[model samples]
Target: MSWARIMAPLSGGEGDATALAAAVRLAEPFGAEVAGVYTPADVADVMPWMGEGFLGGVQTTALESLKEAAAAGEAKAREAMSHVTYGKNAFVSLQTPVWSGLSAESRLSDVIVFNGDSARGRGPLAEAFQQMVADEQRPVLVARGEFSVGGPIAVAWDGGKEASRAARLALPLLEKASRVVILAAPKASSRTFDPTRLQAYYAARGVTAEIDILPDSGDAAPLLLYAAGKVGAEILVAGAFGHPRLQEFIFGGTTRSLLAAEAPTLFLSH
Candidate 1:
């Protein structure tokens, strides 16, 4: 069976379990392997204070908090894993303590799922999640209020490389969708990208897609969302873009905006 793993950052919080449970439910149909990812918190106290005597005490506290975060993360992971009883293919593995700046645990997984709670807070967990989607080339699905899976799927297209990548990556789910709406936001300046090319690509892939030219709105994300709701799309697919210089530090406005919107979305970055 085709497998897609659901990975979420484990910071002791309210909806961590809910996010994992939602992933488990989404994975059930594919008999997918569901895994929980833990990236331990970095204690700010690790950096030494001005005086020499203060170093030892600060280091000790930092080490203890790191231990506590790890222990807490592992405990939560175990609890979430136990709740997943759907299939034998599923398992949870805790990541060993690694230094900061390493790649995200979700980079290797098929699809990464993020809980929507992060949108409101000033927490690093949410910040890390935003960076992961914008920086990583992998597809990510952000879960909203409740775990609702399997509904109409919508594709937002500008006939760019990124948009094409999103369509290709989401084809498996798109095939199962009751209806697939391809919302194109074509602009006048782009002569190379045209309707025929976009339609042919989907047709060759055996997707019976219906195309609609998105209205000239100030923003494309909401415009696409509007079309999605019109067709009753539960999942949104689109290409993501980022500023070249701060690409690692910040996600593009469109990707950040969509994730902030808390719609179940799959994004591909160029």
Candidate 2:
């Protein structure tokens, strides 16, 4: 499989540069288009709170302030995109209804990119990240600390549907890796499956992978991280497991642990 477009949602925050850089790095190998999408705050969302007959100066000033902030954010996002000097790049400034535009762009793109802050729910694009991964079920690459492409990559597999989908969607990236390792803990879970099945699957696609069966452990995140580090992997491909609760996502144990750790770049799909 080949990736044609990579979407990076820029929030005009500290994470924009990391997200854009990672997008460019991924796009360089396949000559994919790096779409730098600027998601500004939507002013329409606050209109209902102001009441119906509240077209007074207070509302006017609030609206103006929102507009000015949006304008400034767009400018910052554009400046961040200008620094990316690899592959095809496009700067897109979303309109007032920014969420809809972001969803549309993410659906059309092959994979979405975010930085660690956004992925960890500590940035302006945190909601966007959650929406794309949990609601839209889009693949995302959480770039952290100088992401490197074409390096040793690791895949976390458990023979589940979610893991299978993540492995399949990450085929394009796996093809570019210098080495691929599949980390599986067969005894850690209740599921009975073969890790070799994934190995054979990759082999059939002209991608050779080594399987590392981890020992029985209560948690799989630490083992996966250690194994990835042992192999000097710069990227880890895994499935994101989470459920929606009151418009927020409650991630699975392993997924949450991985997100909290300072590990490799994560390529995840829900």
The whole-model C-alpha lDDT of candidate 1 against the native structure comes to: 0.63
lDDT of 2 by residue, 1-270 (tens): 799999999988777888988898888888899999999889878988998987899899999999999999888999898888874999999996888988999999999999888888887888998899888999999987676778899999998877888999999989988999999998876788898999999999999999999998988889999999999999999988733334234445777788887879999998
Error of 1 at 241 (Å): 2.7
lDDT against the true structure, per candidate, is: 0.63, 0.88
Tens-digit lDDT string for candidate 1 (1-270):
155665656555556676676677667667667766655565443444433555577667867777787787767766766676667434443444332332545666777666676533345366556566555666666666443455677887776677778778777677666777788766521434665576677778776778878766556667777777788777788876633526623744555567557565444444
TM-score of 1: 0.81
The TM-scores of all predictions, comma-separated, are 0.81, 0.94
Number of the top candidate by TM-score? Answer: 2
Q: Model 1: which ten-residue window has the lowest total lDDT?
A: 93-102
